[model samples]
Target chain A: MENPYIVEPAAITSIRQETDETKTYTLKFVERERTLQFTPGQFNMISLLGVGEGAFSITSSPLQKDDFEHTIRLVGNLTRAIDRLAQGDIVGVRGPYGTGWPIDSAKGKDIFIIAGGVGLAPLRGLINLIIERRNDFGVVEIMYGSRKPDELVFTSEYDKWRAAPNISLFLTVDEVPEGFEWTHGRGVVTNLLGLSKIDPANALAFVCGPEIMMRFVARSLTIRGLAEENIFVSLERRMECGMAKCGRCMLGRAYICTDGPVFSYPEVRSLPQNLLAASF
Target chain B: MVKSTPRALKLENLNILIDAVSQKYRTYGPVAKDGENAWEEVKADGELSLGCAATMLPAKHILQPVRLDLYSFKSSGGFQIEEPGFDEKIALFGVSPCDVNAILALDRVFGGRFVDPYYWQRRENALIVASNCTESAEESFCTSWDTGPELYSDYDLLITELADGYLLEVGSQRGKVVVNGLNLPGATQEDLKEKASRLDAARAATKKRLPVPPDDLHQLFEERYDHPIWVPNAEVCFSCGNCTFSCPTCFCFDIRDEVKPSRKEGVRNLEWDSCQLLEFAEVAHHANFRRLRIDRFKHRTIHKLSWMKQQYGLTGCVGCGRCVRWCPSWPVRRGRITSLADPVEIIADMLEPPEKVEGVERPGGVIV
Candidate 1:
């Protein structure tokens, strides 16, 4: 019998602090010969063994062999416990699950990548893929924002991403503290959209953020002339069994664990309740 | 395999037949407990509640234990999954057809996409001795769904209560093995006819009914998705989760890791969970998707009636009436009747919204 819940032990190779509350972990299966095969935008169920499991996106480039990264924000019991760990700590890994971003659908199209806070972590995989095969897609624009400038993640990788041909980066923050040197848009992420030059008719836009933020991003893109089907957003819910049997991740007919963590704007709108708001 | 003739055993000799069956399997049956029956291990010497009414919990507990450890991780061993193979060959006696239907519903859920090997392991090992209802319990509405009074199929041994003897219809080869060489008299054609008429009488005795056919429930629910009765119902609902706990087909679960004091290792366990609880749908950052009492309440009924069909091509509720019996809310007034968390009443209210009608006095609580 194949036990889906059994976690494979993986040794943490490295950890990098992204913000006061968030860190990126790089891990590889301890068996050494086994490889973590995953496409861009899919997620892995990271287990601290004693603490519990959490579903986080594979935040590294899929083109990279052996290892994958997860950018985790210290939120609940499991993640905070994850923060206490150091390099060489052994953790459990179970996935590479769910539908990934529609890379094939986005091929030969202008691309727009939108992120807010740690939401950028999920898109990082696709961003790396785009950089590696820069000629496969049209003009690529990345718009990312954090509440504060210091909260931005992967700051070291910004220069390398900007160096990719036909790829542009638009960074923003909600606010900045006193005596901080901030040279970026100073508002919500949507404000940075004004700097984008991609034609909506020829582009596919992917958005991820706080639910409210993703809701607004989808609306703004629609107003900017992108068809509802062409705009995709990733959603999160309380998930236990990523197999979709747990029933925790349900949103209307969609089990956020199975049918999507990623859904096009039209599909989101077709669901019964508003995932983006407090109302029905 | 040849179709075996139905057999007959005198009611007094039931214990003898059970003794014959016990040699090859672990027998489970309902036993009297505090005025109600409960599914329990039936020792060869112990009594069986053969003609008893509904049990508090269904036979699902036997197949899927309330708290089964999925796996354990040790500092020394690294990782180990709890046994995924069930070794016991068990036989369940007098399992109601509604409960059998519920088990089948669960099979669809666990069998989808990635099959649940743990559940399938135990479920596949067990043999069912299904029994037809001779009488209806207070909360039963099984006839409306055609899920009780009798089962057409899906059991190993089908037992029917007759006046002077037990009419045993062997449905599978395993059931044939249990009754081999018992020398019980073969059932006459007239005896099978008697069982059919008795089953029909049992069906007629279950007075409660749904407003629409079971096939149309999903569509009807979809049309009445935002029916006004929900808010008032939520106000009365205690959210105590009694309904879900007693429910036959409520398979939602929560997984927890229990680590030892040494912090060296732990075990991950899967246990029954209810959507009625406020925290069932809460994700990170204290954001609960189904935050409102009304949201949770609607989710329970809608998921059972509508969403289950969408996901698994079956009704989540098997018309067992467990939720109706266990819901804590009082006087859930629907069209022409009152019952808490009753699927029939809920659908009846959708057919005729009680609040819309004038001068309808609610039984205990107000909906108008």
Candidate 2:
């Protein structure tokens, strides 16, 4: 009986400026008791009244029931319209859709979470879940990088993540800007894989970022003696309808919206592998 | 439940059946207009263009219109959507066997995962009267895919043109209602034997075929992603998207928001879009996934021949040959002036050994 296209109204409660181009908006359903239940990597379709609709990752931790969060960048019409709105402004929200990260499969394994720029936003919920249940998992290592020092999101939570037992955080910037300050590793996120102490015997890697970045990370993990089946990557596509019917987010047989926003390296390899193509 | 017996109706009593169906639903049938067959509303006394396979378009336009409004919205207050009404109940009379196969493929696309109420509203409620293809067209290759010249499922009524008269096969209980009302004579064993011979001749008439077996097609596309044949084949592609528009199985669509002059209200519509267009895969900042002519060109051919089978159980192309007949651009092939607008031409080239020519490699799954 449910129409997937119909959206429930959610009011933006607060907005945090993550960078010059990105902002994190916290929202709650206007109906008070209505809340969207979701896992770490799943996303929601947000809309601006008459403008348009766009998909955003549910960046909030799964435990947070009263509200949800989405870190959006100034990419297109809907995001631009969303950035201009003040707190308490109501917008249409229609998901928490997609197969999220396989949280149960990685329960007893070492977790290696890698991200780039705003790509870290989608993984933030998974990171929070691991930190909260640190005893349920093994060693945790977080590697993230951005083109510039100012582009890194969730900087405030880095120290807290580092303070957690058995969790190591490695931050990097493609290049530190002039007059701006940065003290972590420099160059692409791939440069820090040499220092990672993750043992391939019992490890699960969750990666997300621009399509190009995930490709490099998957290759780096494979080169480090990790099985293709063990590495999980989040793919990006031009999704209009979160449902599989849109055909926009298709990668071979997989409809990125329904089949995955998340897929194993081996599963992705089995597809035609055009869009995430490797140089022959 | 008693099985309905097949009935034989003389050529003169054809209108009696149409009039019977019209009592329950608004009926539409093929009509000859300017030497081309077009689907038009058939009144009780209207002349039906039976025994024709020259319709310019398929039944897709009937179920999902070229521009169907999903809903209307107002920008003044909170975000809201008002779904359009689902009122009209339309039925098809004398639909081709190839198109019936096309409707089944579309039924899976819209009926799976999230059922599209808009498409099902028309497809489920309306009755279907399918007619087998007795004569093959110039471009039709439906026999290669086993989707034409005969139909086995998804029709309420099946009509086959016999040498002397018409033989009606009631495929469903609904189809029997009309035949029983007319009280037509039961078809003789000789008439049934004539139907089999007619379809066999129709199949033999189709000269074109896909060469490659259906099971091995997926592997072919995988190994030849960067085949050198795509370059020169794409050289004269105008990207006009005529092939996709005329295709019976090309179901890709793009959503558009038509804002009013005052900017206070708008209507959201989903229009059939072709991958051949540059903007079909455009994302933010004008970053296109299939920017090049070859990428868009190869995607359409490969998706239909291979990827569609992987996505859905059936191949997206029913070999209706609409793409071949509708293509506007005529690129040359071999030594003579030939049409390279057909999917068969490109897919055939990919199936063969690659020629040693300088060709650009196709881009990987790149993000915007």
Candidate 3:
């Protein structure tokens, strides 16, 4: 019997500091025979053995089979333990669990990707897939934001993504540092939605960030003539067993672990308001 | 597979059946536990109490234990994972009809899209021996849910009490194995007629009525999602989690890893969890989804009565009434305490329109 509880050990080959509070670990499955084929938006339950486990979105695309990456923010006990690990350290890995982004369904449509802070991690895979099949999609637009210019992740990859044909990239910071020589707009990411030139009716928008940010961006897109069904948002909930069995991640009827991490605005509109509230 | 002809066992031969079943498997039945009846391991015939009104805890603990080791890991040269093994062949004796239904509901949850291998392993190795309820217990509403007094299916063996002796019906091949050497006589048409009347009397004895029919809950609850009843009712709730702990079909759990003092090895455990707890939906960053007590209170009932059916095609509650009996905060009305967790009262109140306050002006300063 395949015990779903078992975590396969993966060796971290390298680590890159994305920000002061977050790092991206590049790992390869210890057993070379194993394949980590994960779709965009699907998350892996990464475990730092003897410490704890957490569910993180698989940032590296399935297009690269040999090595996968998880961009982790230093938040809780498990993530903090993960951040302390050096290169060549082995961490237990399980999953590629939960439903992924509707890549196949959104094909041939203009794709609008909106992300904030480290929330861009999950959408990174989807963006890569879209760029790989560049011709398959219409004009692709990505608007990413961070608290400050220094907090942004994947800074080096921004230029490469912008260089792609028919793709426009926009970056924003909530508060620009005084000493930083930043040239981009400074405000909440939703402020960029009005400047984005994509026709909302023709585009499928994917938004992941703070719940408040996602709500505002979703509202902006809807106001810009995007259907509620066309706008997607990723929900962040407390999950123990990434499987729905652990009810900690319940969003009314839906278990955020299995039913979503990704849900359309219309799908979540019926859910209780407290799930997406900025604070109690 | 129900019996074409039920079997009969003399009153004195009850021990013979217990001995026959326990010879091959560990038998468990309702037994005295700290002044209350509970499911416990029974070795002797005298330890079995088949007629106990209701066990404090449902027999679900046999399959889904309170603290289950999901998996354990060791750090030798590299990491090796070990899954917990379950191979105990056990037979649960004297299970109530509602509890049996609860097991069936749990089967749908753990057996849905991703089959819970651990739960199924225990379920596969276990046998069920159901005992009929001759009279409905206080606070029980099994009759309202079609889950008490008699069971239609899913039992290995069902024992129906009669005036003289017990009518034993074999519902599966495993049941046949249990009764093979007992030399019990085949039940006659007269015994079947007597059994039907007894079940009918027991069903009539149950007075509790569900506020809404199971079929109409989906539509009714969808309309009452924002009903005002949720606020004041939940305000008095202690959020103690007694309702969930005592619930038969509540399968919410929390996963955690516990390491040894040496910090070399650890086991990931899935502990039974309750949605009523404030931290149930709290994330690491301190953002709680169901932070308000009212939301948690509403979540428990909605998940059980409405959402579980939509998700798994089976109701999460089996009308066992354990939550009602075990709740510490249930208010007494006319010297009779009614469960606040009762779907009957909760839904009835939600269906009614909110009381109109006369003197207070509306938020916009508009008064009706």
Candidate 4:
């Protein structure tokens, strides 16, 4: 008899600064034998003792069993508290919840990964998995953009990602600040879609970012002739219980926490106008 | 298996059944609380009021308590979690038929997909003594929803108030155990027939009805998503959340951890939350998905009238009419809150002909 509300203690083994406002925390579950067994694109509800909890995507690849990494940005109260914690600090970890990216299902299809700002965190897992099993996928294209040069995460992994065979990495900065030596594509990440060579008919797109970014990226992919069903978008919603009981994260009939954080473009498009829309 | 045969209990002997049930379980019955009928713990038979009026709140507060501790945590332990369950068994007496249907709907929600142990702990141990609605309330439309005025099943004991006395129909083995030694006389065929006829009359007398059919309601509401009725309706909505609080079928909740002042001890509590609040959809970075009043209004209406039906096989609203009766914005007409706060009326207004309006274009129908 498992109680879903129970939170397992996880020790923060290491922490690495990803950007000015974001850091990646490497955690090891205290219960050594307990395998999280989470797929790429799934999130975990990380609790900071009495502070509260917030859902963060597991950036670590599923192949890595010993440790899990979560790239968190300092946005709200919970995230700020989490960012203040150092190595050896104990925190509550519940989940490995929600629908993950179509890793196995998208095999042999050209994978197009598009992200913006801190939204790149969840997709990082899928990128790593695809690179490890490079033979299983077609040409993999990664397009990521940050608000500024200092806001870019995983600066250390950029070389490794680009070095991977069949993986083309496209990095961009929304605006270049003075005194910052930066050489990359300029403007939003979706702008890179025109510069990339992707066969829409044979490609599967996975998008994660701000709502507007996803809408535009999804629209671009669809206009490029990709099927609406083939384009998946990861959404962020107010969540209390990772299970579907709390009604906060509901988008129409679907509970984003359970039904998906990863939903096909057609599924999101089917929701009512007020649920998710251009102005909304 | 238990017998479905109707049993007769004289008006004076109603307390005998209460006394019998109280011997085994803690009884909860409707009592006058602050000039309103509410379910309260009954210490003696004198506290019970088998009122014709509907209770201000449903029995869900007992089954699924408003603020429940999922577990308590102490700093001394190695991050251990403790789960608690209700200790005492409860018998809820005199629940309305609409509320009985509400209980069934809640059972499906908490029992399905992920079983909520906190809710089930009280639900499994509790006994249901449902009473049929003999007289309709001012805002009741339970008959239109085909959910009330008579209890068919889903309850342990059934009590139907008749002209002379009460007709007790034992539904489950637990119900028979409560009335065991009382030796209640079996109801005659005439009494049983009379109960049916009276219930039929009560159902017909419930004047209010949903404008759309049950089967077509989901599709109709889906098409009315962008209808103009939302703006003006939401404008007057204070967002006080009384409507959801009073609703028998509104089951939205929030779970949070509350720590003691020492910060060494804490408890995770699940409390009822309404979707009408602006902060209900607020996520990280202060981004609220349903920020506008209209967005929240449409979400609540669509979720209850349509989406829940698609998800759970039953419409989220049982037509208990509590929302219509309790909403602060509910228009008072002839000393009673009329259908202005009724969801049926809102949907009806949404479905009105587009030509009636001067410049507003018709909200084109779309089906998903």
Candidate 5:
């Protein structure tokens, strides 16, 4: 068998700018093959022929297989190249790598989602997935925060999320702009956690955001009576190879690429290496 | 066991053997420098430096190149993923037994679990010719680790300098193939016995030892998880990752894709990576795990001594002392062994923990 580094062609069908710096690209199988099968939270290694390759989480749920979505922010070289791509442009994609959110275990349980900035991309997949099977889950709440109102992503779908009876959507921003009409909470995303009426004793929380933001959010949840193990946070590491071989993404013996991009707060806390405050 | 007599070969005859091997293999051997020795690829027997103690770098470069192109791709949606192709065999000559054992240890790692095909390809087609050490260097501690100046099954042949020429012992089929073709004198029983005695004396002469016993290494590290020793000792770590790069047993790497300027062609490359690097554990949202220099330093030691043992049934460190010698930091100096704490005390604490320790509580809510 060939090594997993093999690249296959993927065609971009549409592009939607989520924010000034972040965009969501929709890709379809150019060969007309069956839709790509991947769970929410899993990512793909996207290659722009002469530019470079980067790992981006699938922003679309597994339930939607006809097409897939990748939410990318203009951060470095490869991402900048991807940001320049237009509809019908061809790029190389490998994998639906890494483990996804555990939905089966979330059945009949209340789902609490907390996101910050572009961290919402992966959580958006889970939200859409849960919404599709709305009756299968109990009270669903989403608390999302951005640096500013203009930075909020998926603005087109906010209205639909607000109208859903089974879900409660709470949005927050760090600061309000002059002459801007804002009705939602205006503090950190963790501040919106107080507006939801779910019982922490029976709810599972999934959080993704800036490291500092996630730390505070986790602390808030713990103080609110949520178990440390009940809170899962997605970690972003400098992953060159999304395989276990590369020691780049290692936290002790566990490789983030193979073991997890998602880990419980207690698990992360136990690793002495995981709690270090400086850049790795 | 079928014991073969040791035979002698002149330096000239040895050169011919190397030349013949180089015809079909990439030959690597020791090269003498300004009163020192280093291992490198040699094209002829004249380049062999049998008198050298050890190579500056371990032989890992043969199996795991510093930089390797994993795959290449072109525009028009066409690409090619590179596969492991060991077209040329390898002949490693004048390797110390310690270095040979280091490769064997690496074999247990890269050859199992994920089974690195690239390493395996090179390994399958390679031959190891180890040299029996006549003297030990000041920093050498292979004897303490049970890896020594003598030979093992991992080598294809074992060579020792004799009174007039060199003693050659065929260690494998490949060694026998080379020995049968060499125009040299056959050996007698006395020559075999004398060679054995010389090897035994070399083993006995080794004086260096690791401060900590290998058996107690795991528990020692576990107990020292919060010990102050790591903090003070690791303060000097520069995090340059030179220690890992020069280590024979360290096989960590990073995979990346590089594209041509025209955006039409690209290649996936695998480069040597080290956990000592600051970004080794930084995640997507810029959360760096193992951020502190102390944490990174502790990780390298813990992984080599504890984590690798648990995962692979063998310690990751091969007692090569490269990390100790290569680290630029003062406190990070190599070969300074520290004794392990008692295992019984550690186990007792775990079993007899305080009933009311602060900040220790079970969760009362659902776990994700």
Candidate 6:
């Protein structure tokens, strides 16, 4: 079998700081012929060689892949190393692996995207893909919540999304700082469900965020009449191999690495694991 | 078309054959100490322990080591992927037929799905020489699973100890090549029939049996998906994963990348993994799907009996009884088969004995 751990070197062309701790890095392969081919919601394992290797989702849309983007939060040792990297620095990349969002099936359906904190990284790729092909999709509604006003990511893109026709964007924060003025929805992301006028029967929901937030979002959508299979959630697990050969990412007999990083609430419920619970 | 005969070689010749095989391959066999049993690489003829019941560790280690480096890389744009370098050929001497069957079970697992090239390469290059059981062990229950002390298709050579010498039977083409290359005496038709009869008697000698029917295990486990039996049965589990690591057919592994201090280079390693671990089903956001110990415990059993069969067309458990022997919990025991619902009667089926058999003969006919 071919070794799946092999990584090609890629250079960081630009770095955009999304929040205080998260930054989106645009990487172009050092060898021009070897551009990364990945689905929108799939992730890559990035390594700093001596630092360590960590899994990061591809935040850039597959529809536009002149250069790939990975939005990394300064969390662990590998992410900390990534944060210190400047433009022109080289990093090792492997994958574009795991299952991505079922965008083709979601076509013509009213899309409800719910994201929290850095969990929005993977969903951002789907959102961008939908916006590029705006007419192909039904009503697009984005409801995002962060820990604080300053913690919200993609501040620059928010204006562009708001300007788009037939799209609705609603933002929320747990607490607004002293100097910050907020005019959008307040409290949690799930609380904004009442604001959505789209029909749940004709809509597909994509949720990514903390386990608690996703559980609430999925439950609320299901109660609102969306089928369990129509509500998709992005799951995260510590994965070493993007292939099913590694047992680390298994949810019962299903290897999340191969079967899903994306799954419907019904499939997740059938799994023996308690993924819906706030505390695993 | 005369029946192949069985012949005996003096104990001294057996030693010479082992030495010759060791020169070409990494030879392994059962070695007994005063306190423990182990399978280790034999450097000389004196280390072989044909009388031991079973090695504390299964032969799975030879094909899949406890830890193996899959690939290594350097940040300086240098990378290296390592494949199993089994050029030295392998000879497993004194392996019991049960253990040989265990190896066959592992072959189905690793060779079945994804075709683990690493395991396939080592298994294809290695050779197995199994010894017939003179006496059954207390834990021996291979007969219950229809794979036992008698014989199966995994071995290259099967050796039975006779009154004056050792009777060898060539099983495969590989065995024929080795036997043809060795110097040994020929056997008569009567000698071969005698060995076959003795093997049949030994197979019947094993009294212990797993109570559950092998074919009905899928339905039994599936029907009892929510049974309370799992809770009490799994209560004593330590979740240490010792059972999985020692099992012959447990091929589940985890892949990890270990980087050098320079942070620019690393090697990805394939390490043995256990489903018993809490993090096995953990996803992003620190959520564990099968977080409860009871759930994890039941999940493994169900997978072995039901899910694995659905995916691979074979039962995950080969009835090796390693897990029953190694588990620290006092409640666990080999052949302690339990059904989710009411137990069904187990019917034992007997097969007719074979008429003719071929015995192995070494070339150049040098006894010792």
DockQ of each: 0.58, 0.58, 0.66, 0.57, 0.31, 0.28
Ranked by TM-score, the better of candidates 4 and 6 is 4
Error of 6 at B65 (Å): 1.6
Decide which is better by TM-score, 2 or 5: 2
lDDT by residue for model 1 (A52-99), tens:
888898899988887889999999889989999899888888887887
Highest DockQ: give the candidate number.
Answer: 3
Worst window of 10 by summed lDDT in candidate 6 chain A: A271-280
Query: Which is the winner by DockQ between candidate 2 and candidate 6?
Result: 2
lDDT of every model, 2 decimals? 0.81, 0.80, 0.81, 0.81, 0.72, 0.70
For model 5 chain A, where is the 10-residue window of minimal lDDT?
A271-280
lDDT of each residue in A243-276, candidate 5, tens digit only: 6566666676666776677777776665545532
Q: What is the lDDT of residue B234 in candidate 4?
A: 68
Q: Of models 5 and 6, which has the larger lDDT? A: 5
Could you list the chain B TM-scores for each candidate? Answer: 0.90, 0.91, 0.91, 0.91, 0.81, 0.80
Error of 4 at A128 (Å): 0.8
Regions more than 4 Å wrong, model 2 = A273-275, A278-280, B1-13, B50-53, B334-337, B356-368
True contacts kept of each: 0.61, 0.46, 0.66, 0.54, 0.51, 0.43
Output the better candidate (3/5) by lDDT. 3
The TM-score, computed over Cα atoms with residue i paired to residue i, of candidate 3 is 0.95
How would the docking of model 4 be graded?
medium
Candidate 2 per-residue C-alpha lDDT over B281-359 given as tens digits, one digit per residue, 9 for 90 to 100: 7888998766778777777777888888877788778888888887776676544554567766766777667765445
Error of 1 at B221 (Å): 3.1
